[model samples]
Target: MTSNTEVFPVLETKRLVLREITKKDANSILDYLSDAEVMKYYGLDPFNSLDNALDEIAWYQSIYSNKTGIRWGITLKEQGVVIGSCGFHNTVSQHSRTEIGFELSKGQWGKGIAAEAVEAIINYGFKHMHLQRIEALIEPPNLSSQRLVEKIGFVREGLLRNYEFTRGKFDDLYMYSLLKQDLDKINSM
Candidate 1:
């Protein structure tokens, strides 16, 4: 587990590099954040300008500095450009838990990139961070995200009705969770 004292960790999988988000990534951030299809389920509307992406990178940095969370740019090794982002949205150290969030460029959809990035983070969370659990929240309409979580071993934990207001309306969400114990079991196999 990374402590507040440690610098942001960079994680890597077979085809992706998960590194700390930076202002340099603003253009890449816009590659997905500005897309209607990509931002459809996100809490905010699609970014309309480069400044929005810059602000987003700053926000991500602030959370990392505040020790509240950390996000990584999901860069494909072959492309050498970030196609998405993923990381802990909240790290409740007291509970040894964190909530995971992720998004990818629509152009990269159906390529299993999300799954690879997420699995690397989950492994890092459990093995390095000593985290006990990882949680995910997804809008009910996002079947692909639901499938991604389930494929990563998250257990459906029911719904939170009108859990969040996003894109001008209250949206229902489903909660899913994965425990370290379960991960251990899977790994031992």
Candidate 2:
């Protein structure tokens, strides 16, 4: 397995580039993170200022430095502007597991951009991070997110009632996972 401290991986797909997010991207980050509809199921309130976006970017850096997780900004190859972000967090290296999260601008929805970016990261998690399982926790009401993971080959394990407290209340999340073997099976077929 590769060390998490190594250089951040820049992933690519046919139409997207998954690269590290820097402070300069704060404005683009805020563009989506501050939207109430986009933040609805994200477990955090909409960002109120550019400072909040900067802080969020800092958290992404801290997780990488701490060897806990990684997040990548999603950009189009043609535009090179960040439209979204995705990555694994709450990583437990010893257990070979981690959780996945992602968000995109409302205007970019239904374009299959997120799925492309997420698939690249999932492959990286298994091959580079040596993770056995990558999980996605989706709020029950977030059917779109649930469908996204399912379309990516994740199996819904169950629901974790009140699994997290955010936005001033406890929320139930559905546990969805894609094991490394599952990916192998999909690829081999």
Candidate 3:
């Protein structure tokens, strides 16, 4: 089995493919990244141009190269277009834990696509990366995402007040987590 630490792996679901985000995917991902509505809860402002997407892709590559984190472009299997991105960030190997983050185009909302992608990556984190815990820090106002994480089995730990500044303000975030034990329990069901 290939270790996730040594190589980035492509994860898949029935309708989606999570693969490395590349420069070629910039234009495809540009739609959502630049949409203020989509990026509302994100830590950064909406992209002003395709150049912003390119820069974001480069940043993703840099983190992977440094073995700091892995980000995947969430591609639709039928349409063959990237609709979003998701991945582990703020990874702490010694702690056997990492945080999850994701964003999807406004058009893709309410389709359960994010749930599928999150499930696949969560499995990869537990089974392939041997992570004991995976956490998600979400802006309190992102009800859709909070529901998504909860549906995927992440337990809400607590809220972090003024966690980080985003979109020109310090935002409160809810902390959610899933443990390896939780996955194992479900598998043994």
Candidate 4:
């Protein structure tokens, strides 16, 4: 097996391919941004225009290439479309510890794509990023996301009171995490 520290161009899965974001993916990302239902829990205003979306996509790609920590865009394998974005987030102490986040298209919900993407990113984190622990900060209104994290084996550490200003006001966020050792054991089975 390869060491858990090698960075690759992309990590391919059965249904999705984990890769860096691109300029061309801006419009699809805007699709996700336009949906009020999609952004309801994410705590962000709608993208004003395609240019705004393009700027966001460019930001993700440029920072990633420069090694700045942020979320990654999730692309569908067969369709080659940007259905959502998910990746390492919330850099604390220069990436020594960071959180994991994912957002998918409303059309693709309930298909386990988020889990698959999270699994791939988790493997990437453990194998390549030297990430000791991966955190998932979820909103209280989002029970489905909480379930997804639990199903992926992340333990609910506790509730962070007024941790994030989401959906307008400060919301108590749930902290969920998984260790690299636990991933090693889980994947070994």
Q: Which candidate has the highest TM-score of all? A: 2
lDDT tens digits, residue span 1-189, model 1: 233577788887889999877777888898789899999888988998899998988878877877777888899886668899988868898999999999999989999999889888889889987899899999888999999888778999999999888778888889999999889643542
Cα-based lDDT for every prediction: 0.86, 0.91, 0.85, 0.77
The Cα error of candidate 4 at residue 142, in Å, is 0.5
lDDT of candidate model 1 versus the reference: 0.86
Candidate 1, which segments miss by more than 4 Å at Cα? 1-5, 185-189
TM values, all candidates: 0.93, 0.95, 0.92, 0.87
Total backbone clashes of candidate 2, pairs 3 or more residues apart or in separate chains: 0
Error of 3 at 90 (Å): 0.4
Per residue, candidate 2 scores C-alpha lDDT tens digits across 66-150 of: 8899999999998889999999999999999999999999999999998888989989999999999999999988988988888
Among the numbered candidates, top lDDT falls to 2
Q: Which ten residues in a row have the lowest lDDT in candidate 2?
A: 1-10
Mind giving the per-residue lDDT tens digits that candidate 3 earns over 10-94?
8878899898877788898788888989888878888989899988988888767766678888988866688999998888999
Task: Give me the overall lDDT of model 4.
Answer: 0.77
Clashes of each: 2, 0, 0, 1
**Runs off by more than 4 Å, candidate 4:** 1-8, 93-95, 185-189
Lowest summed lDDT over 10 consecutive residues: which window, candidate 1? Answer: 1-10
